[model samples]
Target: MQADITVDTKGMACPMPIVKAKKALDNLEPGQIMEVVSTDKGSVNDFQAWVKQTNHELVHYVEENGVFTFYVKKQ
Candidate 1:
């Protein structure tokens, strides 16, 4: 599998994380996955809600060593 991914968005705030994620997803073809990593806690909820609103798919997510990693597939 291949992903048009971006990662390690540390030191960013709420909307910036999601904004960058959206921007990356916008550049992908349908069914492509983008992996986003952020230090912001709110990104977990933000990405989930974004996927719901935009009809995209949240493929997977996890946190390790205080970093949040979210995998989203573009619709």
Candidate 2:
């Protein structure tokens, strides 16, 4: 999916991905999408739970060569 903003959290660990995602999401308007590229393996589950709790939509995600790319749309 296309995103209005993209945040690269590659090489960062744990909370950092979520932290950057939160900040990026904060800057977006409702209905805007944010793309996050993270190298942390745990980010898959973390982003899923975070989006559920925050009421955002996890548009989709893909893993290639250990890099996980997530597309989230703000509600």
In terms of TM-score, the best-performing candidate is: 2
Q: Write the per-residue lDDT of candidate 2 for residues 1-75, one digit (tens) a residue.
A: 778999999999988999999999999999999999999997789789999999999998999999999999999
User: What's the residue-level lDDT of 7 in candidate 1?
Assistant: 61
Please identify model 1 stretches exceeding 4 Å from their true place.
none
What is the Cα-based lDDT of residue 10 in candidate 1?
A: 90
**lDDT per model vs. reference:** 0.83, 0.93
- Native RMSD of candidate 1 (Å): 1.5
Ten contiguous residues with the weakest lDDT in model 1 = 1-10
TM-scores, one per candidate: 0.88, 0.96
Span of 10 residues, lowest total lDDT, candidate 2: 42-51
Candidate 1 lDDT over residue span 1-75, tens digit each: 355777658989988998888878888999888988899987777778888999998888888987988888878
